[model samples]
Structure formats: C-alpha cells, structure tokens
Target: MRVVAVLAVVVLAAGCSASEPPPEDPSVDFSADDRKVTAEPFLYCDVQVKDCKRDNTAQVKLEVAPGTPVLVSVPQEVAETPWSVVIQYRTAAGEQMPPETVATFPPNKSSTFEALPPGDGDQLQTVEVKQAGAKLVRDDKGEAAAVSRGVWSAQISPPAA
Candidate 1:
C-alpha cells in the first residue's frame, strides 16, 4: 500500500509540473484552405531621377518598415569645375534630416555617394540633391550632364504571437 501511495504522489507531481509544448517555428510552412504562409524579408528601392544637370537637382523617396536598414547611391560627374554636391533626407514627420556634403570633383570624373537608413524606429525617408551653390544648367549640346541615384532598402517585420 505504501508503495502504491508513493507512486500516485509521483504521478500527480509530474502531471502538475507538466509544461506546454514548444512554440511552432514561424519559418515552417503552413497551409490552410490550400494557402501557404511563408516568412520573407521585405525590401524595396526607388529612383526619382535618372539625370541631373550641374545647376538642377533630383529627388528620390525610400520607405521601409521601422527599424529596417537601407543603402542609397548617387553617382555624379563634375568636370574640372570646383563644384560641390549636397544630399539630404526627409523623415516621415516632414522634418529634414542633416545634409551630407561632397566637396569639389575633378572635371570629367564621376563619383558615387551613399547613405544609410535611420537607426530609429521604422519611418518613411526621402532623398534630395542639389549643387553646392550654382543653379543647375543643362548644356546646349542636349547632353544632360547629371548624376544618377539609386536606393536599396530592406524591412523585417515583428514575429507573430
């Protein structure tokens, strides 16, 4: 009788201390109504302008989920003129972020500029460009001597409960 009593106590204790099964992995494939849900990282890019004259400017908008990282590129050619290029971003709250300045470039030389996404929470971002101090001017030769810009972005959504 004593042995049976001890066995019952042990069984009860084990039942009481039982834990829930491990959570389902989000990456696993699930099909309901013949629909499969898959996990994927979100990413996107936008180009606002293809060409920019020396005195003119171009703009691009890059939007990503909060906490995402993004990379942007701007390529320009400034031949022999001691000219400067300035880049800036606008935040979701309609505020302008700090400006990035690239100093004088040799004539006929092309260079690229890059920017990283904000470290803060997810928000929409915008990019703008302009010459340091001169009004953009397109040459009469119909050659739109300008810069090329590109944006790359990625977003990670929060895990499900």
Candidate 2:
C-alpha cells in the first residue's frame, strides 16, 4: 500500500508539471566575431499573427576583425515547432548565398553556425535577414491551431577599406 501511494503521488506530480506552459521566450543571440550583436530570434513569429505589420523587419550590423566567425547562439529552449536560422553574405564582388535555413515540426532545440566572412582585405556591407517558422493554421476540422517555431542568423564582414 505504501508503494502504491508513492507511485500515485509521483504520477500526479509529473502530470502537474507537464501541464505548465513552456517558456514563450528563449534566450537567442548572434555574434560578429566575439562581439555580440542585437537580435530578436522570434521576430518572424510576429508575421504568424493575424494583424501583423508587413513593414516589420529585424536587422543586425556589426564590424569585426578579419577571420572572425559570425555565429548564432541559442542556449537551449523549449522549442516545440519548426524554426529557421539564416545567414547570408554579400562578397565584395556583390554575391549572396541562398540564405542558410533550418525548420522542424516537432518539439525541438537548436544550435547553429551562421557565417564566416573572409579575414582578408574585404568587408561586408549588409546581411539580408529572413527567419520564418512557427505558424497558426486551420485544422481540417476548421479549428485554429498554433505551431511553435524559433529562428536565428548572423553575418560577418571585415572593415570597409
């Protein structure tokens, strides 16, 4: 009887904790070399809303020493949806990548590599940012459902000559 009671209590406690909502905000950040840059990884989630502003955009610009790796750091969060992290660079020659991205459909977590610009006598002017995942959708039964998502990105460049 004592064992049974203990088992019941454990189950009840586990159920209670699981019912709690996960943290809506996760700690996500970007860096240019070792210097951290301003970022809001969830910016794309704004578009998932019904009355989102189309003009909203998130951008980060930083100048770092040559050969530094632009990086994305997400210190593990309750990621339970498709999330994307993108980073693109424009070479001094005016070229860009197809936006590095990641997505998921299940509860997940992430760590990512954004970019590494050449340390030579070259510089990056701007990084085109596009992070989109996590969404609100209509179910087959005509019900509204929410999907979770997370995203991050970074770009690097040397000082303009």
Which prediction has the highest lDDT against the true structure? 2
lDDT score, residue 99, model 1? 57
- Can you write out model 1's per-residue Cα lDDT over 1-161, one digit (the tens) per residue? 99999999999999999989953311111122223333221211122333322211212223334444333222332222223334344554656567555343454453333333344542324322222222234678976454322211222222233
Query: lDDT values of the candidates?
Result: 0.35, 0.49
Clashes of each: 10, 2
RMSD of each: 23.5, 9.4
* Clash pairs (backbone) in predicted model 2: 67-119, 82-104
Worst 10 residues of 2 by lDDT: 49-58
| Candidate No. with top TM-score | 2
* Per-residue accuracy of model 2 over 5-82 as CA lDDT, tens digit each: 999999999988887664444445666645777555434344454333221344455776544555655544433333
